[model samples]
Target: MTIREAFTDLINQRGWYVKLEIPEGTANSTKKRFLEGKPVTEDKMKEILQRAGYRIKQVELWEK
Candidate 1:
């Protein structure tokens, strides 16, 4: 599947907006391309977070 197609799939699966912030000096090749407004395969999402020391945690949801 194409990169954009994969990203679309991820968005659908999550049912929420996914945003990954790359701190300064940590943008790898693929991530740099993504940050520079280029199309990046969504498969890199996991690797990016893993490299950045992020993990998934459940949190309470609130409706306001």
Candidate 2:
């Protein structure tokens, strides 16, 4: 699944919260970017997911 999809699922299914560990406004902005089809860096995604207790297994790239 896409990182955005995964993150949304975590929020819906796991009840992930915006705790102090993640800088204020980061989660909201990240989610907004994902919804708006903006580019989200891998490092940022990794940091957010890792903080939420998830690890990325693999990443795939494609040319459209």
Candidate 3:
């Protein structure tokens, strides 16, 4: 299925808002930053989306 379709499925399954924050930084920079929300680990979100059959792209997570 298309990525958008997968995303829609995830939202429907969750039945609630799902906010994910990913850290973005280079080796020189140690500061933590988020793409969609505040600083947060990306791995944790991966686990949750696995069941939803969708993967986060562009460092943003899907919310219901």
Q: Best candidate, lDDT-wise?
A: 2
RMSD of 2: 3.6
- Candidate 1, residues 1-64, lDDT tens digits: the string is 4444444444343312334454334444454466567866545665554444444454436798
Quick one: ranking by lDDT, best first? Answer: 2, 1, 3
Residue lDDT tens for model 2, 1-64: 7777766676554335555255446766766686687988767776777787787788677798
Candidate number of the best TM-score: 2
> Native-vs-model 2 lDDT?
0.67
Local distance difference test scores for all models: 0.47, 0.67, 0.41
Give each model a TM-score. Answer: 0.34, 0.57, 0.29
Say which prediction, candidate 1 or candidate 3, comes out ahead on lDDT.
Answer: 1
1-64: candidate 3 lDDT, tens digit per residue = 5444553454454332334332223311212223334543445345546644465556656999
lDDT of 3 at 33: 29
In Å, residue 5's CA in model 3 sits off its true spot by: 13
- Model 3 is weakest, by summed lDDT over 10 consecutive residues, at 23-32
Stretch of 10 with least lDDT, candidate 2: 11-20
What local lDDT score does residue 58 receive in model 3, on the 0 to 100 scale?
A: 63
